[model samples]
Target: MLIWERPEPSARASLSPLSRDRIVRAAIKLADADGLQAVSLRKVAAVLDAGPMRLYRYVDTKEELLDLMVDAVYGEIPAPPPEGDDWRAEVRSLVRGIRGAALRHEWFADLLGGRPHLGPAALGHLDATLTALRSAPGIGDDPDALMRALQAVNGYVLGAVRHEIVELRAERASGLTEHQWQAAAGPYLARAFAAGRYPALAHVVGNGSHQDPAEMFDAGLDVLLTGIAAGA
Candidate 1:
């Protein structure tokens, strides 16, 4: 429902034709380019060559626009098929799609964490996810159990996205590959291990740390799903 426009700076502000969708797209583009701090109705209106007050026809407050933006971004997420042969596979697919969206739009992962859940797109995401979990064997019978499962999965996805974003930012800033980070950390870790200043940390690092996030996610998912199956 959002419309995109590439405006020329020479266009007169008073002559601009603005719609709610256009305003939202401008805000989203601003956030994508300059981070959330750069987004404002006034700023978005200026980008659209319109006045700030014009945006109020659609969005009453900056908060409302942000809510719409979050929904719009979330709407980009692919909702998993209502029926899949395997529930776990379906859930995994849903998480992966969400993760992909977060990766594509770094601001999305950040926005979801910091914003309140108010939009239908946000609720649609939750509804679809819970619906998938409920479709799983055993979860269909208990609403409370289904709620717990959804919460656990949602938390894991949020944490994973945040971790991924931080790693991406670090990689961009340091220009260090995963291998390079490990290689550089190895020497300092070895010295710490030799000194025995932190035996547990030394033992973990010296034994060859398993910091591969995919492995971590798989292990955590396995535990959560296993626990859900057992308890539910």
Candidate 2:
């Protein structure tokens, strides 16, 4: 059975005082500091001053622990402020919330949308998003449209966040800012552009200014919301 389906153990007097909550929190801390690769049952147990075998009482397998960690990150996402009937505003806020959470816990982008998140925190975030989208006046009483709308927004967010995280990871690993990285390969790019085979790429590369990431994400989201509004 999934961890969420299992009843939480009641608090009992004990010297260890260890619980699933503590285990998950410790794992999250490790992940936040050193990425998901740093997390393991043995390491989590070490952090909690317990043996790895003891962890099995709370989590049946490594996958369950990962699920708990993912859910913990979801719990960090704040609810959208009261934006009554303004589906766009509400959704925009929730989208930003998810992005913010991903940025804070880079490992989150690695796990999210990769599997079904059945934990309470994950379910709560999904429920909140659906509620916000359901407020769309034009989408009223149409279950199919509402489901599509939710999936579309979630799909975009998942893809975009993964892309952002990948770029971030690359930048960190290479020890170079994007502009610096581009300049390092300027000679190669110049030769390629001069070939006249990729006119559109060259034109855009020459004409486009460096855009702020946040602004770019917001602009893309706006385009999506506009299309949704028109269709609904």
Please report the candidate that would top TM-score against the real structure. Answer: 2
Q: What are the lDDT figures for the candidates, one per model?
A: 0.75, 0.86
Per-residue lDDT over 78-183 for candidate 1, one digit per residue giving the tens place of the 0 to 100 score: 8776555567767876787778777777888877654347566777777777777887667896888888898888888889888988988898789998789989
**C-alpha lDDT (0 to 100) for residue 80 of candidate 1:** 79
* Model 2 per-residue lDDT tens digits across residues 1-232: 7788887676556656679999999999999999988999999999988878888878888788999999888888888889767888988988898899989999998897755699888888888888877777678778898988887898889888999999999999999989899999988878998987688988988898757778878888888888777888
Indicate the TM-score of model 1.
0.80
Q: In model 1, what lDDT does residue 175 have?
A: 97
Worst 10 residues of 2 by lDDT: 8-17
Task: State in Å the error of residue 148, model 2.
Answer: 1.4
- What are the clashing pairs of model 2? none
Candidate 1: regions farther than 4 A off: 1-15, 82-85, 113-116, 195-219
How far out, in Å, is residue 85 in model 2?
Answer: 2.5
